[model samples]
Target chain A: MSTGDFIFTGLGHAYLKDNWIFRNYRGEAVRGQVLALLGPNGSGKTTLLKILLGALTPSEGSVNIQGQVAFVPQLFQVAFDYTALDMVLMGRAKKVGLFSQPTPADEEAAINALERMGIGHMAYRPFHEMSGGQRQLVIFARALVAEADILILDEPTSALDLKNQNGILEWIDRLARRENLTVIFSTHHPHHAYAVADQALLMLGENDFESGPVGDVLTEKNLLQLYGLPLKRLTFDYEDLNVETLVPVFRNCKRRKAN
Target chain B: MTEKTVKQEKFSACSSGRFRRWLPKTPLARPWILGLILLIAIIGSLFMGAYPIPWHRILEILLNSVWPFSGSESAYLDLREITVVTLIRPPRILVAVLAGIALGMSGTALQGMMRNPLVGPDLVGVTSGAAFGAVLAMWLGFLYTPVILVLSTIGGIAAMLGTMALARVVGGRNDSLPLILAGFFIGAFFLAGVGLLIYLENPFYPKGQRTGNIIYWLLGTFRGAGPVKAWTIAVPTIVGGTVLMGLRWRLNLLSLGDLDASSLGINLNRLRWILITVVSLMVAGQVAVSGVVGWVGLIIPHAARMLVGPDHRRLIPASAMLGGLFVLGLDNFTRTVIWSEVPVGVLSAIFGTPLICFLFWKTKTKGWNE
Candidate 1:
């Protein structure tokens, strides 16, 4: 197998002396591949994402990526009420000269990106006013305008509703497949990862990680170990298509059949 | 590589994109229209003040000065009228306009860099530091215009460095709270330093004719406006403001906060410091020329933002023009309409405080977002 455009070997980080958040993390994501990061709260998932985006340096190890990188943070409110077009146009930040503004062609590219995302109608609408799912799409359009071959997202669907979550998930798959983009994302929902990810990195604890193909890494055992809750990886038929998903055993629910 | 990619991505009828004009929707919001208004105001302001020079005569004086042929035919014009029109009023007017532009542009840049509308040169400790430098220059008996200007710029940069250091110590870029506190701390410290210098100077030079200069610099006014003073402020504002305008578009990206902007391939520290240095130069020059003119720097940008919205490409030029106009108008009001020789600084604070209060009250209606 060929080594991918993105590779991080023996990655580690610590905010304080002798207090590593995580260490000895090694991973690589190739073209058109989707990698999902699964970890409990404070398991250095966001920190790892930052390291890949080059926003922060790991305490020990280095990351090397061959192509452009675009980071889609959580659906956030900007300080100013910039239009969706304005937000997307800023993706040309690299092409824009130090002493020059974005030209008309650059603006056209931004508009085309919005249209490609199927949100061309609301290009002039304020970004802060957009729905959560739409905002994620807008950011995806931004990554496209940036010509990013690597997309790093942190909890892209966290603040979104269930329908919006599906919308985001579909786009994530479509962008990876159609554009041949390397996509790395973190999520609380393992089913979302199981449905989409080719490779899974289960960050169970500091220096303790299980990573490989989804078939190997995303097991009921890893799910239980990762969340400290009884989880079932169930397979069933739904509307003539075979389906596989993870469901956790609840604390109060009487339905213990999955467990 | 970029050129290759550009051609490969086939364009699909994106003819309706809003790049026709970058100005705000309203006619009054246009920077050029406001610039024209400022020109008319500048010409109109020449007719104001204690020595009333008529419009036609002032026009003749101005035209003759520039177009030598007009003055020869217009020898009927009084020499005193020519002097007042061409010499005295123009210098003061230029000084006021330049200072205003400096304040406005500086405020807008500061706000954009900090990603908070509340930030200005004064709030960031630049104005006070520059003021202290100018006062110190006077205390040391160095009245050289360039020396005062240079020292003031150095002082402003020093103060900005202090503010940044303090901000980092407390909290980093994601929060604007620490920046505000640091600015306030450094500004107050510099103001005290200026006060001590003045107190120390008076004992040695009791009959030194320095009190008037002290009051002028501290309170801010056109009392000392002259050709030299105008140049002291003009050079920096024109040069620095141009650089600021040229780089204004980057502010939109920078406003996305530290982590986000950095991820976008911006060298956050380098870009931020460059912008900060330019802002310090302009603000310091204003203080060197006209003293620490208070509320114009702190508040005029808000009025500009109201007219132009938050896009820095439009906002920077709009603020600069709007600032110059505001300063010229304020100076005219105090110089002609008001009975007292009220310092423009005092008047600006008087006018500016209410506007800030109004802005504060407006936040409730606008909903907290920043």
Candidate 2:
């Protein structure tokens, strides 16, 4: 199994018709390896995740995503007012019998996942009313509950406090070391990539990209070229809480202020 | 080996804890209570009607019909007793039960699969489509018993397919909002078409003939329905509903959204189409028999979910039983509560709205999605 390779060759995926959301895109994700898909907003990071999850097939090129993959979508909105526990137990859908309802064992599995994330007390609370950070933790618990070897997450930590960011990062590192689960997640925070991941894939263009060890690939030069800006690395008494800063290249382009 | 296994094991334990929180202990008690209520509702539906039969005789007829020779000679059961038990009561009871269950399961499946609380068979356009189909058949003078049933069934299936196709074209996938919007447009189109058809028939056929026929069909009645009609509707209704029930867990996964559902190896596209078609077909059969009783599709599923929690495994079956009981109980009230027979469709719509609204109002502290 160690020698077994899961690779994508000449994979190009695009969005559906009339939706300018995603254009032709070539990318690759390796098994048993962390590849951080980074780009500006609307760079198709989530689109690529969707293609990998087989939610949408690529318009061009083939993908060789072996084994079952678990996905944690960026936006998680449940239809009903379910408890945090209900959200997590859904992860075991593939494992439970198709007809069989969630048994006592399945419920126990969901609860265990929540407890590991330290949100066990929030298990009974309504999912929609939770704070952003709390929701992120619950979503992570759902992804982990699947027990899938390949995990795909879209923007794993877009909304979280500093403490939760660090706490979740610590848990993720533990997961990679102990579980050997192939984790593929997208995030705007490069620090999260540097802190936990070994490899990074920067989406340089629709068809052009770069992938290598995080430190080597995420150099000052690489950051400048990707964002088209000269980013200043700041150091405080402690480490920078967020990723190393990448100033927008087109700062005076006026889009930054509007956002 | 130990470290990694333990990390995975730690998370596994966390998930187990989540399950404990989500799957409420009260759900186990729900099915039994619902079953008792259903038994009571059925007996009530059987006993209370316009023409009064002694409860003892009704029970005796029910027994003698099945067991035979329970009492011979002066047990003295006449043709009227046989007619009431076999012809009148049995078919009506079965229709009410089957239609209710069908609509209930259909609503639960649609709501769960679509990830929308407001969605059900009517919102999906199955009922309207089926109604149009039945109306078209009747317009063509296919009013004889067997022919009407068959034509109604066909109409229902056709309408269901048409609505689904339109929803897909507009919505891209099995998205709830778009599908619902499409249903609205399609329903409006069909409703107008039916109105036009009725107007056309009025001049061509006898003045009162076309008027009463279309009105009764539109209002969706269980009056004058028989066993043969029950069997026709029951077979497909139960079969399709059973298939939906079998896929209950997958349906729950689907409600979380397509991307999340597929990642769990659900083959989302196939399941989406299969469910859309099956539920449509099931609802079509129910509508063909009972016209287009509205809220049974919308309200019963939610009430059942509220009773048993939203786990489709329990939710679907409970919805079916309770839906049947609900419709039967309502129809019985319509029959005996007043001297004249009321349209069950109107009664369901009028009755269901307040109850659903009240439930929503009481739970207003929580938003639509929890």
Candidate 3:
């Protein structure tokens, strides 16, 4: 099956009655590609994500989504002790009838998704009792079980440790390539985007944004302008491996004199 | 394929050992057990009453009433005994069961929708609003049962809408604290209205009639439940309960919060309103028949959640049956244990409060942290 794509033309959104948060934003996320959205705090990344998910109607412009989309939020708080499998099974809500329970086929799909995410052992564990990273993995499993053409995640790796962050990023990349799924995710780290993203959409502000391949859009200059902080790129070569890392340069230091 | 088989084996291996011994093997078994207990409770209730009737005689009266040709040799079955069994006792017990189911299902729905275990019809002002409407009907001399049912149903919907509006005004959408706070004020407001109606009793009527109606409205009892009242409560409860049960899976998604639910193809606002209306109707039906019975809606759903996990498909039915059993048992206690009949509401609170407290203590350490 061919993957699906989302094309947005002149998209805009406003909070409250008419106060515009972002306007005239345009981008296209192609099928079988990972689009990384980068923005500072209060930069309307979530609002843009909401517009794509059809949770909010944009005031100006239109978006064409090719197929069904699933979202994995940053965190999920379950007030009751639903097992991890039960939580993943909810992804089949669109497929299940209104009054019907999840069938064995659905359960098998959920279990397969969890196993794909390498969390099959956690299927019977209570979702609320699992650690934060494990819970996030289960949520990813939910999105995988949905089998949506487009997967949208809002800061999926923000709360995770370094290892978990890499694990989730690797899964996103693998899912995009192997399953031919369209993936759009927002993150605070530019290096993460560089590591796995095929394309980048940088939200500068209303009427000012950048969207292109990761190689062109995630430069040191663009990264510096995005967060207004000095950054230095360092390359390490050990044996047959070469790694490039971005480090923030702290230039100004003024020691307080003791009274 | 190899990995898939290994994973499948691990899945069953993980599930098989962790299944609790106390819990039933499947979701279906728990409901059957609850149904059996409810049947036992109903029969036991039939046996223990002010009038001491033998179990065999009760069965004979029930069968003879159902089929006239099934005649017993004993002609000593008095009309009083037959009437008491067929007419008086059954209706009251049925009313209790219906009210319990309504309250229990509504509680489960509201708690799931709100994503808070502590919420119920009474806490959210639906019961109080219905109580006020019933009391108003009584004071206005419009004491017809259907009138009370309609007015109370409207009152409950109004109260629920008012709470939503107030929550919007106080905090942004999808804020639980503001909704609970709004419910608190609305409950107090309707309660005050009920109290005012009690204060302004009609002098043309006997003092006992006015005071007695007020007592029934404030502290719920199934005392005067007849076949008409029982059936009146049954229709709405059945309809509303069915709708709630059908929306059980949706409720599970809703408890995941608005953003997550919307992403899963659920129309969050529409689902929320439908749930609120269904819950209001159930609460109103129960309040119309039995005045503002507390704690059944709150405690029974929690108990059911503990028995069966948070899957609402199982939770809703379990809660409804357990609710029926709970109120039926309590009503029996009220009728048989005391020299004078005590309000079932008072008894429910006496039992429900400690259980809720224990649940609060139990679930406090888990579940709340994000």
Candidate 4:
């Protein structure tokens, strides 16, 4: 299928009867293009993604995603003690018959994904023992192993370090370019959108939002409005540094006032 | 790499490979292994009891009992030995095995559904609910075992629904701790109801009434268990277990959290209802037959996970087999090793605690949830 074949639209979603989580949200998410959704936390970024993923039903609008979509959840809740390979095999759940055990091919596919992510050595590691960032990578690999035409990631690099974050972004960028996989990701970071997104979706509020090419939606005015801050997107000498290096600078927002 | 990272990598390498390699290859293998051991243990179970039957004779009697048409023209193959093997031993062993399998898979399913290792009938109100129902039926002079079974099953399912509904009220993902809390409170509510019923029954009891017997059975037992009860419990547990195995993918998806499951083409609401109903049915049937055997459901899953990886395809069947073996083994111990017939429930508590503690200790090095 072509990249622009499917369009995702959300009519609305309300958390309570009155309080709208998202409303009248209409957007076209194309295949083969990386779409980055940017908004403040709890501002319906994840909710919009969930709607697109068909996880949540929009109260007022409709959502349509074409073809099979693989999702990398923001936080994975694992109760059972599964292995890294076991977790990766879960990505193939849609393909494998319900009663069918993981075939050798499935295992090989999982192994390959882990290896490509530089986590081949930890393929047999207990999932619970891995670091948060490492677990996130495994979850990403899980999404990738599905070989779904559309990959939806929710803050995939939120927990990663500098190197891993860059590695993941590069991997995602390459996947979108080469494999022609449509990618939809949600993040709070403006730079991340600038770096990886072909199209940026700015959820303005419960009632307002905009979607366009990355530069247009990630402009200073839109980001400032979205964050509700007097924000400036300044170029720094540490541009070479990945997003993780900027985490301390970004996370210490209250410290700026103290200074 | 940092020293910590290197250590972690080294630790992970050996640990993951060794554990994965150690896991049982086929789901069938665990049961085969456990079944073989349990067969031997059943022979041991038969050897026990007041009669000091020889192993060879026990085997002969067992074979004759099962294969009555086999042309064994031995005078010693009489009704008493047949009664020992067929009437007494088989029914009792069957009950124990069924109870174990039921509790084991129930725990496995509940743990998977709730995503909590600590949750089971005891913590989740199913046991107490069924106990109250069974006790109420008995105290009300319902002499029929089938009636007690029906009442207890309904009671257990009702309690599970109430607990789940309470979780729904809390308004978050249906998680382990919240469901546990819901079960705890609901269980306590049912306990109070049982207590009130007992208080009411006290006025009608004649001298030497043994009111405590009802309470003791609720603690759990395998006494006076017959084949009828075995079939009643076994059918539902086996059927429910089959369905659970069928929905392994959905269960695994749910393990990723509700939203993740929905996105992956699982109809979350439909599945949630189906799984809860099926699980409740199995648990109710089990509670009806065996009062409320504890730990098997909670501990068996962990044990099964250790043997087979947490892939439900393997974990579910393995849990069922190992559970059956564990319970039968414990019941055999309760029957033969002691002067008094100790119930399997009490023994499981006595035994399962130490094993669980050791499990926790063993997995402390590697993350348990992993």
- lDDT (CA) for every model shown? 0.85, 0.74, 0.84, 0.74
Q: Give the runs in model 1 whose Cα sits over 4 Å from its true position.
A: A1-4, A252-259, B1-24, B71-73, B202-208, B368-370
Q: What is the docking quality class of candidate 1?
A: acceptable
Q: At residue B303, what lDDT does model 2 achieve?
A: 79
Ordered by lDDT, highest first, the candidates read 1, 3, 4, 2
Between candidates 2 and 4, the lDDT winner: 4
What does candidate 4's lDDT look like per residue over A1-259, in tens digits?
Answer: 3633457566688878978976766666566789988888788887777777777667776666667877887776587777788888888877776555567777889988998777887876678878877887787688778877788889988878778788778878977887778888888677777888888878888779888897677766776677766445555556676332112135455556653
Top candidate when judged by TM-score against the true structure: 1
lDDT of 2 by residue, B1-370 (tens): 4533543433323233323223344533366678788887787677778887888877777778788877564257777877887679878988888889889998988888778887877876767777777788778876654565555556555655676678778776446677788778777777777787787774557777776867886898898788777986788787887788778877778887766777776667788777877776777677677787997888887777767767676788789888888888888888789888889999988888899898778667655664
lDDT of model 1 at position B334? 92
**Residue-wise C-alpha lDDT for candidate 1, range B296-321, written one tens digit per residue:** 87687778777876788888998989
Q: Can you give the lDDT of residue A126 in candidate 3?
A: 74
Better of 3 and 4 by lDDT: 3
* Candidate with maximal lDDT: 1
Interface RMSD for all numbered candidates:
4.9, 5.0, 4.6, 4.3
Each model's total of backbone clashes: 0, 24, 0, 8
Q: Taking the tens digit of each residue's C-alpha lDDT, what string does model 3 give over B164-190?
A: 789889996456788789989999999
Report the error of model 1 at residue A156, Å: 0.5
Q: For model 4, how big is the iRMS in angstroms?
A: 4.3
Residue B3 shift from truth in candidate 4, angstroms: 16
Candidate 4 CA-lDDT value:
0.74
